[model samples]
Target: MAMFSTGGFAQHGKSKKVKNAPVFSQVVYQGDDKVYNEHPLKAGEFYNPILQGCYPDPAITRKGDDYFLVCSSFAMFPGVPIFHSKDLVNWTQIGHVLDRTSQLKVHDTGISAGVYAPAIKYNPNNDTFYMITTQFAGDFGNIIVKTKDPFKGWSDPVKLNFEGIDPSIFFDDDGKAYVVHNDAPNRGEALYEGHRVIKIWEYDVENDQVIAGTDRIIVNGGVDLAKKPIWIEAPHLYKKDGRYYLMCAEGGTGGWHSEVIFVSDTPKGPYKPAPSNPILSQRYLNPDRANKVDWAGHADLVETPDGKYYGVFLAIRPNEKGRVNMGRETFILPVDWSGEFPVFENGLIPMEPKLNMPEGVENKTGKEGYFPNGNFTFTENFTSPQLDYRWIGLRGPREEFASVLKEGGLQITPFPVTIKEVKPTSTLFHRQQHNNFSFTTTLKYVPKSEKDLAGITCAQSERFNYVFGVTKKDKDFYLVLERTERGTSRVLASTKVELKEPIRLQVKGIGDDYEFSYSTGGDRFVRLGGIVSGDILSTNVAGGFTGCLLGLYATSANDILVE
Candidate 1:
């Protein structure tokens, strides 16, 4: 983990002007949510969202006493974040399944168009683990990766011949395998706007490909097509008591989202919709309920070693303005499978923030090596050579533009690309995990021109974001704030600054309101834009599948116009 800083800053002939790279000494993020403060966690109680902040479309699999879970990572480099846990409550991120650039080829794609709904399953037949997913970019649709050991690494992706999304692999008891995915109805036979079908194919596990001419339609148009369910996707297959079961997400991934189930006698057949469809949902609950959790669907079920069942699904917690800024997160609920169909216990009702811990399982979250859940504070001083897994780059590898300096700091070589472009920029990003939080960073940078800017950016996508940085205006230096919404850009505030030493920048989110401030060699921070609406950074307004990203941005092509 040696630093990558060697060449000095000098102008190359006919190339873009190179300025002194920005050095970020430290970054601090503190989460202080009121919901957690009011309804504090009691003994033997844990939070509903096991993993927060844009970790959606959860799929879990159990191998022996170890459980492995994965989630969708759209356009983020090192796609398909994989986590491991011994007890279902305590989890730790091992590493990404697609860490190499050869496996993740989303460098030219949009922020929301890469990996989607990754399914990780362990095949006891061969003592191997397979991760199947859809890459919306690079024309690499429906691919699978495998590894004998998930703790070490995974193999490069082998593209599967498929024309659909949300592909999952199921291993049968008879040493056979099948792939289930969501696709369009038969050619020209689509009846409604959201009409979709679930198709299954016999998979050749040895060769890692689907057998030709073996595809069959399993569930058409979701449960009860007469009612017209929209977006019947994220299908998973399981076998219990010698019966094959198919489960899917219906009614899109919004407020009407839900999980439905169907049963069949064989691997592929005329599957019968469960009489108790929508085994899990929160759509019918009161929207104004305190600490509300909505859009609960896209679930995958796993059995505990002690014969208990639990489901991992995606849900959201909107701010007071009814806007989704944190994006969809992962939540777990006990499943009651004593009946004909498994149902999420108390999932149909308004969800509570706390859940009773399993018998003899201590809540080790945020401690030892387990991933944190509740309120916490994280600080990074860039002293270590190895970057934490929490820091990620969009559409490209972080090592390409970022390097740890020998003098103990992070040096970001300014990329010619701006944040508004679909191309990968020199910005290190961390997901905005809480609605009420504060993020601050210490920066040592001085802009050479208006085209040179370095500071922080809160981005939802290429079209919607806020740029707050230090730039030179004529002969004077200034701190500027710019907001971009729906591809349009406007400056919110700008102030003159006398930069004699390293400055500090901070952004605080109070419910739906966000404040941007700066400090110059002092403890007092001056608010720049007063209190501005965080609507532009929300998925409701941004219209993407990602949460807000707090980015350490630097660009030689800075375009925030200042008057």
Candidate 2:
């Protein structure tokens, strides 16, 4: 994770070697000076999306020594998967607050609609953890749940009189609180488009009601800010040194179109954009190293206990075939101040994937497992006793997707579900470590009958992804790599590799590219293609927390033979 120099472009199979990485060696003296270095004055530990699979909009709150972060549970039963972190990195899934649809009855919610941007705020006054979300379909409403402890049962979710999506709550320096969100102006008013008038209003946290009426000032991204460039949505308010900053993402949440920062002095006012205004455009996500172009701008600010500020924005690491990202990933940057202004000294900076460790975690030594010869490795038994934060699921997660084998190896069952129907199921995964990194899995594939491909996927979304596996077409086995991008499939490579025995699959992913090969003998590796690279796309285009992921996937035209 430490860059010795701001280095080169590509360097062999290990493209994970970061390029042009700036070393803040001067930071050794700058903090005491008035003007800090523009880039990485003090880079906190880098945070990879641990809850990668569909965990979007991570609202993090710290209470005492415990840190709580939750993501939107879109259409998942256990709506909001709450996570606990300390030192703000290396998180483990504690539990989900909304477990039953009974308490969260969004029957009318679309296939992928349920909980929207939930701000987790712990009120120490009564020691109550308050969770609020935009209930998109049931009544198209705002709801609140209160619990003395998050791990315990939550009280009933009381719907607010508000109507909108991506709802967030801002509790001021004073005990005064307010719930702010953009309503579907397209639905209610003159039947205009949805991005028309995005406004902010006050709320009564005590009574779980709206203190301000529908007539609130349009903070940004209405006809006014909308004219600037990008669609203004997902607004959150923060007062830094008396400068009330209302920050929101624009240009929609997909592609490099996202404008990270547009600020305002008043919660509702002539909100101004940061000079670094289009604060975090993905124009810099190098096309060669990153497969997808660039994207992931929806963001919120988080300040550490040390009063250091950082913006948690999203980024996409593309896969091969150049499909856009399927999910958005959470990225961080340090903010330098120019008088009262919050400047993105490093927001647009391409974060190198280095390991800046948290202060408390005792272990920095990566766990060992099966790895070819590289910097990254995957163990049979996960080094982390629980689960690695690097892994994320579609929604929350379930134990059924996998379980720990008693023999000290991770025994993965064939989860036949695809990206569309996995339903937050446990399909343990890790972010692609490099624009190019090889992922190989040695397993025995026993077809239940025919038409089953069990293997690994450089998967972004159900539509935009690829997999390499063994399929029994007519009782004959063939090794194949199927590219599934935007609901279409083109076989990249297929061969009649008879299954006289079990085989191992290897995937070598380089900057925006990959190679899928099969090893029946399991001694040496073969090149499936001439170094197939992927696009820089990720699920962020599809909307979720995480970059493009190298996930283990298995599917069956019929049932699969367990091996």
Candidate 3:
């Protein structure tokens, strides 16, 4: 949050006439080189949403002053994006943990049912980093992935038998390991809807298994056993001052989302709920919450080298009337433990735009971890040797199919179905970070058959998206546009086009409005269609837990004939 230098107020009374002066920008660039540049807040103040768009269920750990973070990527391949921060404010993506297809099995799964909360921790004793997550769709219940060097690569996976989701590992001071996860309700426990419990198991690291007969319910129901909370999941255990603290999110993932803490004297606990439950939440503080930020919970606390505590949580900045197009984002808040319990800044209120920076932290601009400053345009000229990590595919790794053409631009081979088929659909896309921005790409292809197609897509999920492509019907080529919402897709607009060269497709996002346009290697362009509510590409309308992924796509919806 940098502010530009400018004059204050000029006299404008009838006695003295004021002249219209040229307004100068008052924005300033701080940081190492000004890597992240945006003036939505005051100068010298940092903004919330450390990581933007669809980065939910944050899990963070600090090692020797270096902070590494991983978020729930759900169906997005190369899942569990790993980010590193020096000061905890400026973060840069080191790489992804699940970068290979063999490492994950998300094929044919819904966007919301793929990957759940992942926990990343470092065991200093063994000098190994472990990441554990749940694949809600596949047979793998809870898996652990370890790495010697996080930037280099990670092991395939060691599957752990767990009945529920959001599994996390914790090591005790005596070198003993334990796993805490949500325990699914059994047959007779039909007391309340979404009735779930948090349980712990002895983790045998060498054997890569949860010790049998050691399972016990630590915090049943929730902080308040009387209320019978639903979905008491995303459990994480932390130890400090000889007291084991379990942090978890309860009451679903929507407006009632909250972060609560329980304390126990032993690793296996008849844990006691903190007197002041919901250590961090913004679910009920704001009156005009529909238009502002809402739903903040699922937190992981990290103690900095300076002994200061900060918690990372997931929140959503609703664009309009409770429509969360950007999905859940990662936000950081200062945790002051000088009191009886941890109290977030502003004391259980909705997060503010500007927050106090960590002590002795320097603001670095144009840094690798921060967003690129100035322009918001991204173009793949295809001159580069390899595809950037920003481009991600459906369940499998994009490189297994998608390739860069020697001619120019990206080349995506056909899967079986278009965006209509949610699972196993071959597509590549990037998150739409800004509400008002333009995404354009040039497709270099000639339809071998009428089924050959490639173009731009704005996807909320596999079942819901807007694809603007150029398809061939026999000898003629036409601009094809289709919109799908909740498994229902209709061809909104299609027009003929004669192209002797590569055709450029563009999608402009203006708040809730989206306009599609195309051009054939010239300044003149044809408006395919527009005025489509961008909210239709939002999670609120699409009924999923993901944000809009707008990027290039090419699919052979029919099938490739095998020789």
Candidate 4:
């Protein structure tokens, strides 16, 4: 298997000045299988984020007792990660929808410029799962794929001629299927910056083609003509109590983000806005200084077996500077439907981390809780035949450059793609799930040239990153600490070291700061430099839709694809 890079970075013109922030780290999964807050498990109680770390735009569907869900992967190669849940609380990753390169084509994508929002739905009639998503700014526009067994593999993509982002498929009760998406306007000119319309098209799922003449606008701009919200996206269609409900995210995806509902008598007709418009939003709520789960919207609903309704939506946890480095994570909350429409809460949704699980659902997974119990540990021994499922690549697959050593450890071949470019960078990374954690890795190879380097990195994107690399200059070895804030990169510290011995690199994350250190042979690591502010790598600072990635990488400026 080859190595790959993951996560987005701060880009030009979109970069925000880094702010001085305090240290804060939320305890997620420890090393052991137990939640950090070890409250006794009950029948109707669980934590939020069934899936964690840059897992956004959650689309969940249930088949009998088994629940299957998926999330958007952006530029990551294995796009759309799918998970299985016996009860919505405990979820295990089954596989990826676009696991093979043939199913997905990604190359030289900018930060958050690949696959946008993915809608995964199961068709009971054919017993197959269909996943439709948009390849934003990619070679293909909208694409679809399916699989009988989600764990094994999915078929190649069926490219759709839809010109929009966040495409979703809705299979009506009458067996007719339709796709609702944020349709682009005509080519000439626009009155506003983000003026886009929502449209629905008659789709032929069996033949994997859309009917030509059946396209029509369902929503002109967005609800509340007075406010005139722009960027009406993340559209999902549903039927509730004989009324067709069309839910979409409006007012862009930042602070003003919100979920609005539209109801219509017919599947495709004049739709009216619900009285309780902007049903779920944190814009009015006080800034959550504690968890920072603000910017709540872009949701998908799923009804449980016991007739309980729950909505999985996207939310962010920002740092002290209001800069979100964790990206948009998936959050689940129960929907109370006692009134005319389904309500997530009485008013705007609250940051309810501890929620009551769906009724009649017991913990059948036999696990203690959703997260592990230790302080936060990810030690890849490199003993497995395949790389860990959590490991991700930049724009390509693991077969591109990195491989696991037979005896132990990992061997990352130096690729010609420099860390400066977003495309073709050779790196293998996992989500920096915890706010505070320590990452340590031992390097077995020595750099032969100034351009050839290998070590660990905490990256917001290819253009914005913090790298702790091993390098050589003038036949002397050195440990280097480099920081790439937006488009600017510079070395913070470097020291000469003996090249005969293996090197150990360490990066300790404390809230919005990262401390880098390294050792020559033993565990006697020395600090490389002062604490590096992490806000430079935040989505707010970096201006991307992804969180930070903690992983290993190797760079060869010569474009060589080998060691």
Q: What is the TM-score of each candidate against the true structure?
A: 0.96, 0.69, 0.88, 0.89
| Weakest ten-residue segment in model 3 by summed lDDT | 4-13
lDDT of 2 by residue, 306-361 (tens): 77665555565454545433354445455665455565544565545433455555
User: TM-score order of candidates, best first?
Assistant: 1, 4, 3, 2
Write down the lDDT of every candidate, Cα atoms only: 0.89, 0.54, 0.72, 0.72
Tens digits of per-residue lDDT, candidate 4, 307-326, equal: 87888899876666677776
Best by the lDDT measure: 1
- Candidate 2 Cα RMSD (Å): 11.3
Query: Number of clashes in every candidate structure?
Result: 0, 46, 18, 18
The positional error of residue 90 in candidate 4, measured at the CA in angstroms, is 0.7
Worst 10 residues of 1 by lDDT: 5-14
Candidate 1 vs candidate 3, TM-score winner: 1
lDDT of 1 by residue, 345-457 (tens): 99899999899999998998887867787788878887766676778888888777887766678888888999999998899998898999999999999888999999999
Residue 533 error for model 4, in Å? 0.9
Could you tell me the lDDT of residue 207 within candidate 4?
Answer: 95
**lDDT tens readout by residue for model 3, 1-563:** 11111110101111111121111111111121012243343445676777766788899997897889999888888788888788887777766788767677888787777788999988776778889989876677789999877777789888787788889999776878999999776669757888888989998877767999899988778887688787899999988788888989988888888989888889899788889888887777755743266788888888888777888999887764467777898888888877656656663875666576676775553353354322244444544335445567777776554554434344455665677665655676777765566776666666656666667778988777888877777677788788877777778888888767767777876667788888886766678765687867887888778888875666666322211
Off by over 4 Å in 3: 1-43, 287-291, 369-379, 406-408, 521-525, 558-563
Model 1 residue runs over 4 Å out of place are 1-19
